[model samples]
Target: MTRESWRTRLGFILAAVGSAVGLGNVWRFPWMTAENGGSAFLVVYLAIILLVGVPGLLAEFVIGRRSQRNPAGALYRLSSGSKSWGAVGLFGVVTAVVLLSFYSVVGGWILRYFLASFTGGYFGSPGQYFGAIDFGLPAVGFHVGFLALTALVVVGGIRDGIERATKVMMPAIIVLLIALAGWAVTRPGAGAGLSFYLDFDGTYLRANFFDVLGAAAGQALFTLSLGVGTMITYASYLGDDHNLASDGSLIAVLNTGVGVLAGLVVFPLLFATVGELTGPAAAGGGPGALFVSLAGAFSQLPFGQPLAVVFFGVIVLAALSSSISMLEIPVAYLVDEFGLERRTATAALTCLVLVTGSANALNPGLFGFVAGTLVDLMLTAGLAGFLVFVGWVLGKDAVTEFSSGAGSRVRSLGPAWLWSVRTILPLFLLGTLAVNLLALAGVSLF
Candidate 1:
């Protein structure tokens, strides 16, 4: 059987953007923004995205396009059959499983909220409503349902499933978010919310520079769907004609734009009704803060029932599109490395996540740890290793891959991109890795 590839360039772009613009954009990005001094965190995060995110993204693209294989196979083949590097790639496959375990649980919650919006399900006592549905058997059922939806897409293979789904989803997510933002800002007293979200407080940034930096760095990587091999897997399907640099930049831009747009809707609506950002509901920005708070806010607004439906509808689409990417990583591994059929590979991996994700839905403590610190560490480590491999191992080949199909302007930047990826970028990732590890160990040496 031949390997699968995207049917069109637009299909690939939309799929990658769909992967990048997930729940992080809708939920985590806004909460992180509000909690970490609003725009203070945004400034730091934007810097990191340009400095770290784009380069890191290119590194993955180089590897994926160069190898045209899944992470494990890519590393193994690229390094002249080095089992050790292959181990690192296999770790990525594991990381995807770990990621989906918690991610699907949240996706399930979003799916439920999207459904409930139609009937005003959580319109009463948003906080209590979240507490009721956040964990245990009910959450487990929803998680399974979400996992089923993800698997259904992946089973359809690349173009027929992932690409086609994302083409519609990406557009819907953006258009609806724009409509929501327009509606939100028109409400009375929305200017204050916009101010809170966009105002740059130099004092707050200077005082909590490291705190904001670390938070921003993590969010930057998380928002782009980096450190998870999703991009690597996605790029593996690209033809040599598609410009990786251009596509990557576009993904970063669209993801960021959507994130900022989500803030437009979220901040104004929350401030308009809820009065202020209700952060710290759980560590690393919880669903409670975004989901429950917004649910309550909608309850207060006139015609909120319809607005709630659209809002959660966007979330569901975003979450599904991203989760499909997450699921694709390991499925690509199974199919690429083992030569298993795509459908068979997807089924096996789906069953695996079903059990793992159910554990998270049933246990709050486990979910918090996996979703917060554990994911951060895995993505940080996974991406750092990829950058190091690109620089120290793939090196010139990485440069060639990056330059392939790039415009003359972008092609010229490949060497500089290479130097940074080889030295500066990995060091930056390691520095952040250390900070994450320290924070994990309860040592706050920012």
Candidate 2:
């Protein structure tokens, strides 16, 4: 059978952006900013995105388009059919599962909050409302529902499933977020929210450079969906005629814009309504901070219920768009490596994630650990492995793929990019990985 290919360049770009823009951008970016040093973290994060994230993205694209296979197979075949390279690809497969295991739990939270928005269900007591529904049987049930939805789409195969779904989803997501962000900015005390989010504080950054740098790097990668083979997998579906460098840059640009837009909506709403920028929401709020906090904010506004529906509905689309990408990794692995049909592979992996996601729903501490630190470590290490493989194994071949179809400007930068990818990027990734691991180990040497 012929390999699958994207129906259009635009479709591939939207699908890639859809994968990049998720709860990580909407929920986690705001929280991480608030937790770290507000705009200081944002500044550093932007720097890292330009410096590390974009180049890393290009590296992945070079690998994917050059080999045109699943990560494991791509690595093995491209590296003289080496088993070790294939093993690195398998690590990416594992990273995908780990990413979705906790991601589904958050998706479920968005689902529940979307439903609750119908009647201001959690209006009077946001804290109790969140705590009541956060984890346990109901959360697990919802997580399963979300996971099932992801599986159904992925099981349908790429064109009919991922492409078709994201085509509809991506536009709706953009419109809803624009509407919500507009409305949020118009709220009373919206100025405070804007101030909190946009206000620059270089002093804060100067005082806590490494701390903020570490966080910004993680959030930047997380927000862009970098380091994971998601970019590679998505790029693998592209035809040779596509301009990989151009497409990758557009995906990065679109995803970053959406993330910034999400922050525009989220930060304003939080400050205007909750009076607390960082930390947990009022008593009704818990793990899924954005859902709880934003629902509460919308509940207090005019036509809040309908707006709430629109808001949560957008979030649902965003989450599913991303979740489908997560499921695709393992699904691709099974189909390419194990010879399973797309439907069969998706079914098996969905069942696996069901149990894993349910475990996250039923346990808050475990969920937090996995979603936060564990995911950071896994993606960091996974990306590190990829950069090394591209820099060392593929070497000149990676540069050839990068320069192909690239404009003269982008093509000229290829050699420098290759050099950095081979040396500095891998070292930086490894160092960050170590710091993250030690921090998780309760022994922060940094």
Candidate 3:
């Protein structure tokens, strides 16, 4: 069979943006901002996206396009049959599975809430409702439902599946989010939420600099969908005529912009109903804070049921978009490396994740460990390995790949970009990994 490619450049861009703009943007970004000095964390995180995230994205793009292969195939082929580099690609394949295990569980929750909205299922005491339904056999069922949706699309292959789905899903996601954000802003006393989110808190930044930096760095990488070879896998499908640097920058900017937009929708709704941010609601920055607070906000508002439908509907699209990308990494590996049929690849991996994700849905402790700390460590390590490969192994050849379809301006920055990927960037990623590990171990290195 011949290799499949995206039918249009917009399809690739939309799919890239879809992969980047996931639960991280809508769920994690607000929580991370609230947990670590609010606006100050936002500023630092934005800087990291530009400096670290974009360069890392380019490094992945170069590898994928040059090799035109999956992460494991790309590394093994690029290195002339070196097992050591192949190990890095193998690591990415594993990380992708680990990611989907927990991610599919969360996607399940979002889908349940989306369906519930149409029927006013959780309108009475939304916080208690979330507490009741967050985990158990019901969560397992929902997780299966979400994973099934993801598998269905990916089974269709690249052109007939991912590219076509994102072309429709991406537009619907943006339109619905914009409408929700606009409605959220017009709520009574929304000014407070906007101020709290946007106002710079310099004192907090200075006092918790290292803590904030670690959070910002982790979030920057997570929000961009880096470190998992997702970008590399997608770029492998690219034709030589596409400009990766420009596309990479555009994806970064759009993802960040959507994150800011999500914050506008979430924070204002929380403040509008809850009167003010307080205690765990402010400090705990993840699914718990998001589901409870947003549920409460919706329950108290007129026309909220429909609005809930729209809100969670957008989240469903966003989550599916990202989850599909995660699943694609391993499927691509199977097809590219072992010559499995695309449907066979998708089915095999989907079966693997169904069990893994169900385990996460059944246990809170395992879910927390895998979804929070384990994922951060794995992604940080994975991206660092990718950068080192680009910098040390691929080096000049990496530069050549980067300049392949880039224009004059992007081409001009190739050397400096390659330099950063080689030296400072790997050290920076290593520092990030160390800080996170210390924090996990209660070492307080920062």
Looking at model 2, how many pairs of residues clash? 5
lDDT of 1 by residue, 1-446 (tens): 79999999999999999998998899888888888888788888889988999999989988898899889899999999999999988888898899999999999999899898999989987778888999999999999999999999999999899999999999999999999999999989788888888999899999999989888988888889898899999999999998988888888999999999999998898888867745333322565678877887899999999999999999999999889999999999988888899889999999999999999999999999999888888999999999999999998888888888978999899999999988998888899889888887898874
Where does model 2 exceed 4 Å of error? 277-286
Ranking by lDDT: 3, 1, 2
Clashes of each: 0, 5, 0
Q: What is the C-alpha RMSD of each candidate to the true structure, in Å?
A: 1.4, 1.7, 1.2
TM-score (all chains, Cα) for each model? 0.98, 0.96, 0.98
> What is residue 92's positional error in candidate 3, in angstroms?
0.5
Clashing pairs in 1: none
Cα lDDT tens digits, model 3, 379-418, are 9999999999999999998888888887888888999999
How would you encode candidate 2's per-residue C-alpha lDDT over 235-291 as one tens digit per residue? 888776777778877888888778888878887777777676333334233356665
Question: Model 3, poorest ten-residue lDDT window?
Answer: 277-286
> What's the distance in Å from true for residue 440, model 2?
2.1
Clashing pairs in 2: 126-284, 127-283, 127-284, 127-285, 128-284
Distance (Å) between predicted and true CA of 131, model 3? Answer: 1.6
Question: Which of candidates 1 and 2 reaches a greater TM-score?
Answer: 1
